[model samples]
Target: MGWLDGYVALVTGGASGIGRAVVKRFIAEGCTGVGVMVRSAEQAQGLQDEFGDKVLTLMGDVRSPADNQAAVEATVARFGKLDTLVGNAGVWDFFAKLEKMPIEKVAESFDEIFGVNVKGYVLAAHAAAPNLRASGGSMIFTLSNSAFYAGGGGPLYVASKHAGVGLIKQLAYEFAPEVRVNGVAPGGTVTPLRGPVSLGKQGKSLSAIPGFEENVANVTPLRFIAQPEDHAGHYVLLASKENSCATTAAIIQSDGGWEIRPLR
Candidate 1:
């Protein structure tokens, strides 16, 4: 039997990248239904075409409180309960150093990046808390290696991930004996991770950058770039009460040896 047999989940940004991968894997592991939060009609249609009635796609911005609540409500309404919340939506800063951007632009970019990366997780957790608590379920956030060490992104992106660390810990503490809270930190996966609009990079994606795959492989200790599927199993483990019941306020480092990168 699948680890998540009959489980119900809601995933933010579940239309693309790592989020989409997690949804695919969850279904394979026997989830009854998954509610996916997407930004466009295209994304909604794409999920429907792929997963059929087992998936419900909702259109909403992750940064909105109303949208987060609506997504959670819809998931429970359709599936009859909620077992997991995967807060996987985020924005990158594209390595824009603090000094390179004008102060005004930096301020705007910071807000946009943190709005999706940090606040999105917080709001999703808040919205899903009651259902998760009711089922003794959990919350799994997608973090990055940048959450622990530097150089994953510029200050704004890095700081946002670091904040996610604190958020997970605090939530785990507060939701103790019931809902668990945890994270998975990946490094340099070839996803369509987008940059902030404030930096004029709304149309740009991380995987579309020239030499990105090569550059990531060159610097990563594993000497290989990861696929979105590579990190999807971690979410499954964190979501499975039978598997990771004791895991709370902890982060699984799926960064391919990023912590051991050569000091030279």
Candidate 2:
């Protein structure tokens, strides 16, 4: 039997990037059912084409509590139970340095960033709580190195990540032995969450970070940036009953070697 032979999982932002990778990983590990809550109909169709009915695509905004509730309800209705909820939808904000950033930018960016990252997680957990309690399942949020360190994201994004770290602990306490809550912090993975794309013409030049890719590659003890698939295994491991029964409120840092680089 596969590690997740009878598991049913829901992945927010599941049509692309790390979320897509997680969905693929779960299916590969023998998860019996997987649902991907996407933000676009075209992306949802693409996932449906790829996985047929084994993957359910719900197009909804994570910012909406109603949408989150409906997605959770749809998953349980389709699969009979919900074993895992991957809160992987988030946004990045760049243009706003704390001092020079506009008040509107701060408000808009914080609202947008926290809307999906923080509120979405809370709503998803609230919606999935009873089902997870029934199955003694887990919830995993895709966080970033930004949660622990600065510079990956600007002021607003960094603050949002820090809040996510707190959410893991808070939810873990709330869910307890019945349902586990945790996060994965991956450093320099090539996720679609490129810095501040929404900032348009005013966004920071990601390429200007001084040999950003090569420097990141060199700094990591692993000696390379990771692909989304590289980070997916941890999700499977955490969701596995045998491997993770004793692990909860844990933040698995899949950050290559960002935490231990030599002083430069």
Candidate 3:
């Protein structure tokens, strides 16, 4: 039997990148049904076309409480029960530095980033809490190695991820024995999470960190960039009752050992 054979799952940002991979992986695991909440109608349609009846696609922004609630409700309506909520929607402001960035600009960064990453997770969890409790299910968040290390993002993005770490602990405490809460910190999956990174005040691109190919070959010990599928098993494992009991508040660092690289 598939790991999620009898369960229903909701994945936010499920149209592309890691979110897309998670959706694809869960379906392969024989989930009873999969619902993907994305912001773009075009993207949602593509997913619907690809998966046909086995998947449900909703077009909505994670920043809206109504949207979050609607996605949860729809998942239950479609599959009859909701067992897992994967808060995988996140944003990164890579094109600017904190000091040189204007206050308004920084605030915009905060709103865009936290709106999806933090508030979205909380609202989705709140909406799904009842159904998850009924199924004795779990919540899994997609975090980044930035949560632990500095320089992974601009100050604002890094701070937001750190907040995610706290959210994991606090929610785990709040959810208790009936529902489990955890996070997976990925080092660098070759997704579009990064963009024209800014230097100090010049809006310079931070592309010097290393190209995707180089990051895999020169930085990661595994000597390869991770595809989204590389991180999918952790989600299945965390969602499984047998494998994840007593595992609340835990963070599985699925990163490629970048945390230990000696400063050169």
Candidate 4:
């Protein structure tokens, strides 16, 4: 029996990067079904090709309330109950400094970055709350070391992730004693995390940055960059009642010891 035996889950941004890894891992852990919210038909087709009926891929934008709700309803409908909600969709600001942008650009970038990273999570939580409460399930969000430290991204991206910390705390409080809410903060991982369109970086991916992996490895205390799979287990643990019971409003830092970075 796997950790998530017979479980059902809904994951946003489940097409690629850390989000995709979580969907794959959840199924490997014996999830009965995983509802994936993706933005493109290609993503939906790719998931179907890989996981087949094990996953139900829904094409939609994470910033949409109806899409989030549809994903939740679809998961419970297919698997009979919802056990986990993984709010993993997000956008980065590519380290776009605040002072460099005009005030108007800043506003647009903030909306785009926060729309995907912050508001998306909020909508997913709202949609999944009832189901999670009914099944005594948990909510796991994909945060970043940026949520705490700096230099992970630009002002918009970093600030958006920081907002997630508070979101988790508030939601955990609202759903206490019945459902748990938590987060996984990953360091520089080699995934195709996208940038905000507001900055004309929508076509660019995080991993495509020149020497990104090497740079991340050199700076990180662990001397290595992470892969999406490295953080997937944290989500599994948070989703498992046996492992993380009584744990709520907590964030597990999986960023290669980010708290002790800079090598003193």
Candidate 5:
């Protein structure tokens, strides 16, 4: 039997990239149903086509409390109960350096970055807390290598991810004895991760950067760039209470062994 047989899950930003991979893996692990929160109708349709009734696709911004709440309510309504909540929505800053940015742009970029990365997770946790507690389920958030080290992104993106560490810790503490909270921090991976509009980089994607794959591979200790699927198993491990019951407020690093990268 699969680890998540009959379990129900909700994954924000589940339409593409790492989020999409997690949704698929959760199903393969025997999830009875998954609620996917996407940013567009097209993405929702795509998920519906691929997973059919196995997935409940919701279109909304993760930064909205109403939207997060709606997704949880809908998931519980359809699946009978909630088993896991994956907060994986986020935005990159495209490495926009501090001194290089216009003073006016920094504020806007900060809000957009934190709004999607940090606040989105908090909002999802807040919305899913009750349902997760009721089912004795857990929460998993998608963080980044940026969460621990520097040079992953600009100050805004890096700081936003770092904030996630504290959020997971505090939430784990607050929800203990009923629910567990954890995170998966992936390093550089090939995904369509976008940037903040305030920096005129909403159209830019991380994987689209020229030489990005090569550069990441050269620096990573594993000597290869990761695919979205590479990090999916970690989410499964964290979500499977049978497996990770004793694990909470922990982060599984899946970034090509960034810890062992040679010093420049």
Candidate 6:
């Protein structure tokens, strides 16, 4: 039997990239059903085409409390209960330095980055907390190397991710003994991770940056760039109470050994 057999989960930003991989992996691990929160109808349609009724696709922005609540309610309504809430939606700052940005732009970018990366997680946790507590389930958030170290992105993106570290810790403390809270921090992965609109980089993706893969591989201790799937198993491990029952307020780093990267 799969680790998540009979379990139900909700994954925000589940339409593409790491979120999509997590949804697929959760299903393969025998999740009875999965609720996917996406940004567009096209993404919902794509998920439906691929997973059919196995997935409940909700088109909404993660930054909205109403949308977050709706996603949780709809998931439990369809699946009978909620077992896991994966907060995986986020935006990059495209490495825009603080000094380089126009004063007005910094404020806008900060809001947009923190809105999606930090506020989104908080909203999801708030919306899913009751259901997850009822089921004695867990919460998992997608973090980044920026959460721990520097150079991952600009001040806004990095600081937002660092804020996630605090959120997970505090939430884990608050949810204790009933619901577990944790995170997965992935390093440089090849994905369509977009940037903040305020920086005029909403259309830019990390993977499209010329030589990004080569640059990441050269610096990463593992000597290779990761794919979204490379980090999916960490989510499974954390979500499976059977495996990680003793773990909470913990973050699994699936970032190509970034912690041990050679000093330059």
lDDT by residue for model 4 (132-192), tens: 9999999999999999998899878888999999999999999999999999999999989
Better of 3 and 6 by TM-score: 6
**What is the lDDT for 219 in model 4?**
86
Better TM-score candidate (2, 3):
2
Instruction: Write one digit per residue (lDDT tens) for candidate 6, span 1-264.
Output: 999999999999999999999999999999999999998889999999999999999988888999999999999999999999999999999889999989999888898999999999999999999999999999999999999999999999999999999999999999998999999999999999999888888899999999999999999998999999999999999999999999999999999998898887
Which residue pairs of candidate 6 clash?
A: none
- Candidate 5 per-residue C-alpha lDDT over 67-158 given as tens digits, one digit per residue, 9 for 90 to 100: 99999999999999999999998999999999998888888888889999999999999999999999999999999999999999999999
lDDT of 3: 0.82
Candidate 6 TM-score over all chains jointly: 0.99
- Candidate 1 per-residue C-alpha lDDT over 166-254 given as tens digits, one digit per residue, 9 for 90 to 100: 99999999999899999999999998999988999999999999999999999888999999999999999999999998899999999
Model 4: CA > 4 A from native: none
lDDT by residue for model 2 (1-264), tens: 678888999999888778899999899899878988987889989999888888988989898889888998899899889999999987776435777667776676667777777898889889889999999999999998889987776778788888989999999998897998989988876655645333452244443455767866877888997888989999998888888889999999998867777777
TM-score of 1: 0.99
Backbone clash pairs for candidate 4 read 95-154
The RMSD of every model to the true structure, in order and in angstroms, is: 0.6, 2.4, 3.3, 1.0, 0.6, 0.6
Model 4: lDDT equals 0.92
For candidate 3, report its TM-score. 0.91
- Candidate 2 has which clashing residue pairs, if any? none
lDDT of 1: 0.95
The residue ranges of model 3 lying beyond 4 angstroms of the native Cα positions read 194-210
Residues 50-72, candidate 3: write the lDDT tens digits. 88877898888888999989999
Least accurate stretch of 10 residues (summed lDDT) in model 3?
A: 196-205
Residue-level error in angstroms, candidate 4, position 150 = 1.0
